[model samples]
Target: MRKAIIITLVVLISSFVMAQKPLFKVDTLSIELSDLSLHAVLTKPSNIDNPPVALIIAGSGPTDLNGNQPMMQNNSLKYLSDALVENQIATLRFDKRGIGKSVYPAFSEADLTIDRYAKDVRSIIEYLKEKQFANIYVIGHSEGSLIGLIALQDISVEGFVSVAGAGNSADVILKKQLKPKLSAEYFESVEIILDSLKNGHVVKNVPPQLNALFRASVQPYLISWFKYNPAELIKKINAPVLVVQGTKDIQVDDEEAQLLAGACNNCSLAEIENMNHILKTIEGGMQENIQSYSKPSLEINKVLVDTITAFIKNYSK
Candidate 1:
């Protein structure tokens, strides 16, 4: 009876201790921008008192806080947040204005400039600052890298990470992406449209097939996006920067990472092998790589995460 009582007491005590241990928590947050409200997901370690925090900016074109677009759903950013929490770090990932929960009908499409995106990030960084997070970092994936770099100009942070960001200007990147798929004549038309937009003029003669990418509605935004070169902007950042690229990424290549690393005086580069644009490890052709965009089940490349973790930890030290 005494032995059994002792065992029961131990089990109860163990259960109590386990219950006392806190798990990571998530909170749905919002920041107001004039008439619109930007939606965000804040993830943090439950036991951490003043954990280092990262502002995770998603890529372009309607990517949500979880890094999903309308046609595809993937938890790339969500997985990244969880990984950060596992390392006792806090993170805030948000939807860009006019994307996901931030899409308000009252907002004009013309307001979608890279500057606006940078301002939104700055707003969040200011909020985290108010919350007393001593160490703040920014991680931008794809187009978010450009936005984050721009944001760094206005708001200071400990470090910045660019994942699969294009080093060239938007016009140059677009031309490269269209070269293989477009006919010679159609390619000329693309050049004309891009040139007009580069000169701050909108063209109404958009080809039917190209309307989705270079439509009149998006021209103003494109004009704004075209003015900034990622390489040039990255050179202006004073904070430590990490340029991360995947070897198998179909959207971006190693050259972009190299260019970015070369531009920044304080920068480190990490190229993950077999990792695609969505940060998944896929050792296959283009079809298999593209298919990974919607596969949320696959985790981000561990090397990518480890590289970021080590970079931040070392910088903090």
Candidate 2:
């Protein structure tokens, strides 16, 4: 009985150790901009050599590499990376300048422009190329979609995926979101400010209610963003494009994906049912969709994973 118990304990310990081992090799690397050193994680399948690599850019705000901000907590991007690894695809996710461990103290929001973000992505692409990653792709979510679209433009990439990206320019989307909430006077003020910014000018007389969104500190960055029209940019992409949108997304709708598909010569659109802005399957109403943003345990809608992986594999083959 004692010998049998010892053998069972040994077997269980061995199994635990094996299970503790990571399924893929992860490297926490840094990419240096002029003054900022951006932090990133590269996850690759342990068994595959020269596997397809994706540059996963997070959405708007201070969303980190794992798709979470300081007050927000979610494992959407991390789970997506795991899903990709299972499908034999590798991913490199990073914290953009002035976010997470890559924070730049000297840089203000004005320093954060669309061009700066694109250049950072370009640097990462160069790094991946140096490592000899043959199949390289860009996967941008929400605002990252615009960033990815601009970055991929002048760079050599296998394909591009826009996840929950906006179809219209920043001004148009802002008008849509604020129309129902703001008074006519306030809405007109916003329109005027947006138009001025779009036309290479900034408005100093900003409404107090709109200060948070159009703060002076972020106006320059907003101006830079306002210059790119998602639909127009999609038309310019030479590489294959995959636009994914969730039907239940409160922030962005399926029409955005459709616009992208219509504009791109080589584009595939996937409208995932019941998925929200954060890419989790909907369970209830708006509250449930918001709750999913904090639920780190919830897996991203499997259809998203399957759709993306299949797209990558199709081209790879």
Best by lDDT: 2
lDDT, model 1, position 240: 92
Candidates in order, TM-scores: namely 0.95, 0.93
Summarize candidate 1's per-residue lDDT along 1-317 as a digit string, tens digits.
99999999999999999998877888998887766788988888998688888899999888899989888987998888888888888889998888888888887886578888888889889999998889999999999999998888867899999999989888988888888998999899999999889888889878898898887778888998888889998888878999999999888878888988888788888889998888888978888888888888988888888888888777763
Clash count per candidate = 0, 0
Q: What lDDT score goes with residue 248 in model 2?
A: 90
The whole-model lDDT of each prediction reads 0.87, 0.89
**Which residue pairs show backbone clashes in model 2?**
none
lDDT of predicted model 1: 0.87
lDDT of 2 by residue, 1-317 (tens): 99999999999999999888877999999887778789999999987788999899999999999999888898889999999998999999999998898987797887789889998999999999999888899999999999998887788788999999998997788888888888998788888888998987977978887799888889999899999998988888888889999999998877777887788789989999999988899968988898898999888999999999999988873
Lowest summed lDDT across 10 adjacent residues in model 2 is found at 252-261
TM-score of model number 1: 0.95
